[model samples]
Target: MNLDNILYWFNEVFSSLIFIYMLFVILVYSLMLVFAFLQLRKDRNLDKNLEGKVNLNAVYSKPVSIIVPAYNEEIGIISTVQSLLTLEYPQYEIVIVNDGSKDSTLQTVIDVFQMEPVFRTVQNQLPSAEIRGIYQSKLHYNIVLVDKENGGKADALNAGINVSRFPYFCSIDGDSILSTKSLLQVMKPIVSSNGKVIAAGGSVRIANGSEIEYGSVLKSVVPNNPIVVMQIIEYLRAFYMGRIGLSRFNLLLIISGAFSVFSKEYTIKVGGYNKNTIGEDMELVVRLHNYLLKNKIKKSIEFIPDPVCWTEAPDNLKDLKTQRRRWHQGLLSSLMLNRGMLLNPKYKQIGLISVPYFVFIELIGPIVELLGYIYVILSFVIGNIYLESALTLFVLFLIYSTVISMFSILLEAWSMGTYPRIRDSVKLLLYSLSEVFWFRPLMVVFRLQGFWYFIRGKNDWGSLTRSGLQKKTNDTL
Candidate 1:
């Protein structure tokens, strides 16, 4: 074939394949949206307020140990603990695992809570760094601190698990602020299941422009920053569209470390969190599944929708890029470590459905979409390609990126009143239009960078320079 004809044929074949793949992905995401809609619709009329005296103290039921692994979290550590203290769950103890903070994180919490030395012996069931000392708050009997050597977040969690006295332990991010009833809400499934459910995760909301007091989100307002607003929309879509749907069929592989409840027994049995992987939360979850299916355990992990774990989204592009890249890297690492389960009948739905979905849609989907974008650009500039093909792919990108996000905003409105104001919701809807053109492409590039980093064996848990949730938190406290 002539050079011109060769280029034409190549463009035709590539564009056609991309078009079909985009259609398939859209169909899949559409199904997830429907599943999410049904799930939310089913619980729409239920009296959530009357969840019935959720916090009844440690003696009444399965008391929980909330583990907050802090690494240089001086800015937000105090607020995080303060928020936990206000939790409606009455029977929970707060364990702040200070993972050798280089800053004043250890001293701040100690001085703030007037924590004194306490010689509480732990079984040390999990392998972790040596603990320097354990301290308990004089103000609150339930609050404890573990000062340990620097061993990353997973190791810190492992240390927390070893020291935790309860059957159920919650892993919460030190920089996050939990709603008063969030802990109770997240634990509802586990409590209701009576040991059938092993782990449960709550929805994480962005707290960028929200009103806050004493580590509690007093009011939920959408941030004015466009980037932060886009992240808010992304969170809405990811949790409502992806998580709710995946959890319905017991195919959930990831529960955010920001706020997730796990059975200490099951976690220990599966070898706790993998300290070596950046995606420790995901790796542990996949291992939990692998262990359960391989050993014929009947327990399941879940993602709960109502509980709100407010977290700070990276406001600027630089921090946001780092966060996204690291996230994608973690996702890839988890999938690779558990590659044996992929399409294997032994692991059942997790291997067959969840693994494939994450592999095809979550990981490889970005690269494919990136190619589609490139083709669309070249097709527009360089002649000989069909105009209709370019238009079709562009429309598909719009539907995939922008339309679903708008729907997620609608879902947020219908179910949870996180952003109740009409104007903020309208603003988010407006910004989502630009996602296909700008935001999504940027994410694809960043995520592609993550793939490169993963190949290079980059294991650093990159830090985000935080602008604390509440500027005057320490001074006020």
Candidate 2:
């Protein structure tokens, strides 16, 4: 065959595949719209129920042991611990695992809370480094600190989990601040459910440039930087729209590591967090479900949309890229680790539905879509295909992006009403629409790099420099 003929044939095949992929993208967006609508309805109902029902006195709840895995978190450790002490829950203890910080993390806690040595048993251990000493807060009866050798976040969590004595435990990041009623919100499902509720995850918001008073977010204010501001919108859309729908179907793949509450027994049963994968939060949840399936035990992993936890976002481009790259790597790790469950009939929706959906859309969708876009642009440049076809595809992409962003905002406004100001909501809407053209492609590049890094077998836990939550007068509000 002639070279021209070969190129023509190849182009034709590629164009067909691109068209099919575009169609698939359109279908996913359309389904997201439907899911968004359903979620908005639920959000409306939840809002009505949640408005007057945030009262923590509603019921007697089980005591919770909050586990915060801290590694060199000197900037915010004291404040984060202070905030936990103020939570509205009646019975709870705070356990902070200082994972061999080279900073004054241990000393600061010791000074602030008048720490004293305490003895405790690490009941179950999968794998972790040595413990230096366990300290209890002289000021707060419920607070305790474990000084441990350097390990990864998963290892730190395992240490905390092993030390916790409560029936339920919440694994939280050092930089995260939980809502006063978040535990109550997550615990409700566990209390009412017929069987054990193994895990429950709550929504997380960006805390950049917000007033933080003693570890709790005082108000919702958009960050000054465009990147951070856009992240705020992204979190809203993700938690409100994506997680809510998945949670409804009992097929949520990840519980946010920022604020995920788990039953102590089930977590221990699954060997705690898998220290191997960067996506420890998700891998543990999937392992729990797999264990349940294996043992023929009925369980649930619930997601509570009303319970909000505020966390800091990357302010600069470098940090943002690193965070996104790590996230992509974690997603890849999680999917690869659970490959056995993909389309396996026994696990039902989790195996046949959620796992495959994540594998295609979330994990690998960016690579496929990016290549498709490149092909369309090249075809236009070569003047081979009609310009109208490329233009139509571009329009379709815009429509998909705008629709999902708009739907997510609508769902949030109707459901949780977190972004109360019209201006803030409008800004989020605009950012979501703009994400497709800007943030998404950058994400694609970063995620690709992540995949490459993982393939290259680079497994170092990179240091994340903290600027601390944006300081303002309302820092303690």
Candidate 3:
């Protein structure tokens, strides 16, 4: 056949595939709307029952060891630790693993927390390179610190796991801050599950420009920067809509690195986090499910909607691109590492459904989207104006993205009422519109770069220059 004939056939095939994928996308959004609505109702009912007595002290009375793996976080380590110490939880220990930072991270923490070096024996069996020393807080009996060699984030977490003296361990980013009650709320289902809950993940809010006092958020005014505001909306959609449906099906692939709790025994049993992978958080979660399925164990890994942890988001293009690239690499690493489970009947929903969906839609989504865009643009440039076909394609995409974003907004308004101000809601709405046109394309490009980079064996961990969370001290309010 001639080139023209081949081009015509390719266009026809691509058109059909795009339409089918768009349908699936629409259906996913539709189901998400239903799930978010249901979750919103459940949240409202729970809120009514715990009105005045909804403090972390009342709900989560269990002992928890909060593990913070820090590399070079000198700028915010003191503030983050101070915030953790002030959390209203009755029983919890703070473990900070200093992963061989050349900066003043260790000294800063030691000086701030009044640290005294303590002799603790922890077996470094997880293929970690080395450990320099371990320190315990002189001021707080519950706070411990480990200064280790330059192992990765996964390595640092494993080091923490080995030393943690609690049944449940909460993993949080060094730069993130948890609400006092976030631990209490996240621990409720774990403790109340009668030993059935294996893992629980919480929602993470952006703290780019929010007014954060000590460790608590006094008010959540939108950021002055457009990038930060867009991220705020993105988080809302991801947590409120995307996770609700995924959790209901027991096919959640990721629990945010900002805040997630896991039963220490189960986590240790799964051989800890995968050190070689960039997406260790997700890899661990998937591995948990894989273990449950493989060993015929009945356990629950859940997403708790109410518990909130706030973290800094990238406000500039360079930082945002680096973050997204790492995210994409992590996703691919998780999927590929667990590729054996794909379509394996033993893993059931995770294997047959979730894994395949993520592989198709998420891991490789950007490439497909970019190609589709190219094909459509070529068609428009060429005189082959399939007017009805183009219109259908555009409408389908617009409706799906808009509907998912809208449903997430509605869920936020109904469930937590976080975006209370009318202007914030309106900004989110404006953001939703901008997402399809502006943000989505940029994301696709960044993600495509990630995929290609990964394929080319470029897996270096890029450092994100933190803009830092907006401290209340800086705000006039």
The prediction achieving the highest lDDT against the true structure is 1
Model 1 off-target regions past 4 Å?
A: 54-59, 472-477
Best by TM-score: 1
For model 2, residues 1-477, the per-residue Cα lDDT tens digits are: 999988878876776776777688668656755775776676556553464365445425567889999988988887778778777787888999999998998898889999999887777555778889999988898999999998889999999888888888988899888777787777777766733677899999888777777677777776557888778767766787678778877888898999989888888888888888888998998888888877778887878887888887888888888888888888888888888999998887788888988887888877886886786577689774546566766776676566766777777787677757787777777777787788867877878877987898776557677877525534211
- Angstrom error of the Cα, residue 16, model 3: value is 1.4
For each candidate, the alpha-carbon lDDT, in order, equals 0.90, 0.79, 0.81
In terms of lDDT, the poorest run of 10 residues in model 1 is 468-477
Q: Clash pairs of candidate 2? A: 212-475, 212-476, 213-475, 213-476, 213-477
Instruction: Show where candidate 2 strays beyond 4 Å.
Output: 1-5, 46-61, 384-386, 473-477
Give candidate 1's error at residue 12 in angstroms. Answer: 2.0
Q: For every model in order, what is the number of clashing pairs?
A: 0, 5, 0
Residue 52 lDDT (model 1): 41
Clashing pairs in 1: none
Estimate, for each residue in 243-360, the C-alpha lDDT of model 3 and write its tens digit.
Answer: 8778877888888988999988888888999988888999999999999999999887888888888888888988889889989999998988999999998899999988987887
Alpha-carbon TM-score of each model against the true structure: 0.97, 0.93, 0.94
Shift of residue 411 alpha carbon in model 1, Å: 0.9
